[model samples]
Target: MKLTNINKTFGNKKVLKNINLDFPTGKTTVLVGPSGSGKSTLLRTLNLLVTPECGQYEFEKQKLDFAKKISNKEKIFLRQKTGMVFQDYNLFPTKTVLGNIIEGPTQVLKEDKTHAITTAQQLLQKVGLADYATAYPHELSGGQAQRVAIARALAMKPKYILLDEPTSALDPELELSVLKVLLQLAREKQSMAIVTHNMVFAKKIADKIIFVENGEILYDGSPTEFFDPNNPNQRIRNFISSMTLEDL
Candidate 1:
């Protein structure tokens, strides 16, 4: 997927500014920056959850002009191709884990009920939640809920998986559980673009990193260069320092 000259505004504030980016297939692209830097908004744009006022988005050989109004059908089609996992697991309160996982496939995709159930079960096993199939959202721990959220995203068989601060709410122990699942996905070369503050995990998993601040991309390069302690970019160095202090 690719975005060229993208722009978005909310009220008097412009959250995204002429953003140009590319997410290569079968690679992990990590979006990292301080809070309110538009990382999450950019991730949302990948799935068209947050539309830009102007830009061109190309995904799966289909190009969309954001300057024009995007139809509901187009939005649904794009969303189905790009699965999204939020900071908070947005599971249905009344639905079971299995139910949440199968909803998109069975309803949106019109996939067979039995086939969807089988796929959900396999995804549950992959995310280490095989035994929680019958459990509701409120019954699971934060980590478990997040895993369920990941499973739900995978069930759609999307071309790309976009995540926004996926482990922000978890403690170190719980965070590791979720990170392990992500790491496994990275190893499999799943196409993903993630907004995260976890620098360590970003360095470990990212094939490319983009640093955004003040609604602009200040850096876009390999993880090695971006994370290098001796790098000359002052802003990036300072941001990393602050994030380290926050971790302490």
Candidate 2:
């Protein structure tokens, strides 16, 4: 995915300014930045959840012009290529875990219920939540809820999954379990863009790391280059200093 001259402003506050970057396909890329750095805004723009004021986005060779209105049909097609997970597990209050997993496909895409159920079961097992299919989100812990969220995203079989501080809401132990599931997905060549504070997880699974500050990209390079002591970006340096090893 490539973004060019992307800009977004909320009222008078600018969140993204002239942002230009490319996200490689089939690679795990992490976007790391402090609060209010616009990482989440940038990710949301990619998924078309937040419309940019001005910019062009290129996904798999298709150009998305934010200046123009997109048809619902076009939005649906783009959504098929992308899935999003949030820090807050946004499961439906009335849906069981299994229902949450299958709802999107069965409703949005009009996929067969039997096929959706089969895929949902496999994804639940993948996320280590096979037995929680009948359980409600309220009955699960934060970590388990996030795992179910991941499962729900996977049930769409998207080409790229966008994760926004996925494990930030969980405890350390729960975070590790979810991270393991993510790493396993990466090993299986699932492409994803993760916005995270966990620097260590980025180092371990990310093929590339993009550092952002003040609505602009500070650095975009390999994980090794990002950690290199001689890197010139002050934002990168400050971020490293603020992070503890445990945050990884």
Candidate 3:
């Protein structure tokens, strides 16, 4: 996706400001920053979950105007091209894991129920939750629910997966489990834009790393350059210090 001249504001606060960026295909591009630094808002804009007040979103040669009126057809088309995994693990308490996974495919994509079940089972196994197919959201731990959330997103077969702090609520071990799955996906060249504060994981998985602060792109480069200990960017250095302490 190519973003140009993007801007978004809520009430008096500007969340994103004149952002110009590009996400290359088959790469893991990690977004990192302090809390409420507009990283999450930028990811949401890709899927149109949060529309920018003005911008040009170029995807697969199709350009959409965020500043103008968009048709329902256009929104649906964009949504079809991407999926998102939220930090809160948005799942249906009333639906079992299999039910949650199949909802999008059977209802939105109109896939056969039998086929959806087969796909869900495979995704469950991929996320190390094959036995939790019948478990409800409340019955699972934080990490398990997030895995189900990732499976649900994959079930859509989205061209890109936008992850928003998927393991923020997990303990160290649980966070590691989730991060391993993400790293594996990165190795397999899955297209994803992740919003995370996990510097260690970001350094390991990122093909490109972007740093956002105060509603603007502060830095965009490879992980090697972004995390260089001798880099003179004070803001980046401070943020990295905070993250390291938090991790400890």
Please list the C-alpha lDDT of all candidates, in the order they appear: 0.94, 0.90, 0.92
**Residue 122, model 2: Cα distance from true site in angstroms:** 0.8
| RMSD list, candidates in order | 1.3, 1.9, 1.5
Tens-digit per-residue lDDT, 1-248, candidate 3: 99999999999999999999999899999999988999999999999999888989998968999879877888898898888999899999999999999999999999999999999999999999989999999999888999899999999998889999998889999898889889888888889999998899999999999999999999999899788877789888878888888436
Q: What are the clashing pairs of model 2?
A: 200-248
Of candidates 3 and 1, the better by TM-score: 1
TM-score of each: 0.97, 0.95, 0.96
Compare candidates 1 and 3 on lDDT and give the better one: 1
lDDT of 1 by residue, 1-248 (tens): 99999999999999999999999999999999989999999999988889999999998868999999898988888899899999899999999999999999999999999999999999999999999999999999999999999999999998899999999999999999999999999999899999999989999999999999989999999999998888899889989888878436
Q: How accurate is candidate 2 locally (lDDT)?
A: 0.90
Off by over 4 Å in 1: 246-248
Candidate maximizing lDDT: 1
Clashes per prediction? 0, 1, 0
Candidate 3, pairs of clashing residues: none
